[model samples]
Target: MIQIKDLHKSYKMGSNSLHVLKGINFNVEEGELVSIMGSSGSGKSTLLNILGMLDEADEGSYTLDGVPIKNLNERVAAKYRNKFLGFIFQSFNLINYKSALDNVALPLYYQKMPRKERMDRAFHYLEKVGLAEWSHHLPSELSGGQKQRVAIARALASDPKVLLADEPTGALDSKTSHEVMELIQGINDEGKTILIVTHEPDIAQMTKRIVNLKDGIIIDDHKVEQIRASQYV
Candidate 1:
């Protein structure tokens, strides 16, 4: 579903350039559940940004679902990003003023989907995430796990080709993390391509494959016997 080759990225810091990703290469097939692991200064976040089209690589290639992801104008880039990628971040990234249902419907709003259709779709996903009863609650009114579920629902509401999660469980307690992972596992079971960036070993074990990144390159990539998150939840 996604491919990357000889990917390189750098940023200027006054007089010197800080190389973040150097010659990174990998491919994630359709329906695969993968984890990208790295410590501080590793390029996992940068890689996710490039994949999400929020940033561009200085060198190399990225192809998502058969289309090249480079040299696009902002308008085209935004269009592709909206159509192809869904994101979940550690911070939840919800608008505090908006109710959970409105937050999920926001993306569909940008897609110019009809009001009734967007709301209906958003509610369906919220229901899928087990948040239907709390749909009217604001982000501030929900617990950490509830907020994350709302965020996940919002991500899925777009029905994108890939789901990229950056430290998705970083902020939650262990039990809540497992519950969220359980939900994620069920999603993958239905054939959604997911890439999670996490440092926790237990969290990484839940995925079908793990890709370890050091400095700027993939140091190890292998498939594992998947651990069902439901056992822990």
Candidate 2:
């Protein structure tokens, strides 16, 4: 679960300040799959960064699970981030030289999990994402969808509370994109809270709820009948 109220963010450009998020407010319940939809410069990325605790808001409040996320020291923030958030980026963010299994195992390694358990968990998640057979492949050896699946497995390997995805399907072809969305939808069905930041209407529709952002504020927020990505895949 997540909550935000009256959130505001801005960046200084020399003498001028560019406002990115103004009076943003929203909550995501446990197990809900939600998409934040916006055009470029509409503040979706700023909102996602704040939600992921990768950046701080200039004003307002953000509470993840039950802890206040404000004014925390970097060490504490990193701890909370590792304990609660899993991130997926459009670029996949895999190390070029790491095999898929090693990439998925990296987060657990950072957590200091035992090597045996880390590899077991990594292989489990890779299997969950239908990438077990590709475990030895590097990012360069896999298709875009396979790479994204590896990324998804890496994100899940840590067993975080929420998955924060930025433009998850942006870099793939339509069929591959839908395939990835289908995988995401399956994850959400198992009660993982997911917040996806995407501009694509069709991508947003795959989630249960859509929050439309414009001019740095939420313009519309509503739940809709979910569209199954498997249909398109």
Candidate 3:
């Protein structure tokens, strides 16, 4: 469902260019739950940004659902991003004043969906994420786990083809993190392709495969015996 070949990325400092990704290559098949593991300067974030179309590679190619993800004008890129990718972040990235329901509906609003339809779809996904009763709560009113659940619901409201999560459980406690991963695993069970970027080994093991990155190149990539997060929860 996703393809990358010899991807390269770099950033310019004062007078020197810092290379972030060098000759990176990987492919994620539909319905695969994978983790990209790396340290702080390992270029994992750069790779994720390119995959999410938030940034472009300086060289090589990326194709999402068979469309080349290069040279897209901002408008076209936003359209394709809405149609093909959903993002979940460690920070929860929710607007403080918006309630859970409205936050989930925000993307649909950008899609120009009718008001009634957007509201219904938002509530449906809120229910799906087990946050229906808390739909009216603001981000500040919820606990860390609840806020993250709301974020997950918001990400799924669009029904994008793939979910790109960066440190999805980084801010939660172990138990809460396990609970969140359980929800993520359940989502994957229903066949949504997911790529999680995390440094935690346990979190990585929860996924079906792991891609290790270092100095902007893949060091190892392999499938693992999936560890159900429910066992820990």
Off by over 4 Å in 1: none
lDDT of candidates 1 onward, in order: 0.96, 0.95, 0.96
Q: Give the TM-score of each candidate.
A: 0.99, 0.98, 0.99
TM-score of 1: 0.99
Candidate 2: regions farther than 4 A off: none
Residue-level error in angstroms, candidate 3, position 142: 0.4
Mark the regions of model 3 whose C-alpha exceeds 4 Å error after superposition: none
Number of the candidate with higher lDDT, 2 or 3:
3
The 10 consecutive residues of candidate 2 with the worst lDDT sum are 72-81
For model 3, residues 118-192, the per-residue Cα lDDT tens digits are 999999999998999999999999999999999999899999999999999999999999999999999999999
RMSD of each: 0.7, 0.7, 0.6
- Kindly list the per-residue Cα lDDT of model 1 for residues 1-233, writing each as its tens digit: 99999999999999999999999999999999999999988899899899999899999999999999999999999999889988899999999999999999998998999999999999999999999999999999999999999999999999999999999999999999999999999999999999999999999999999999999999999999999999987
Q: Candidate 1 overall Cα lDDT vs. reference?
A: 0.96
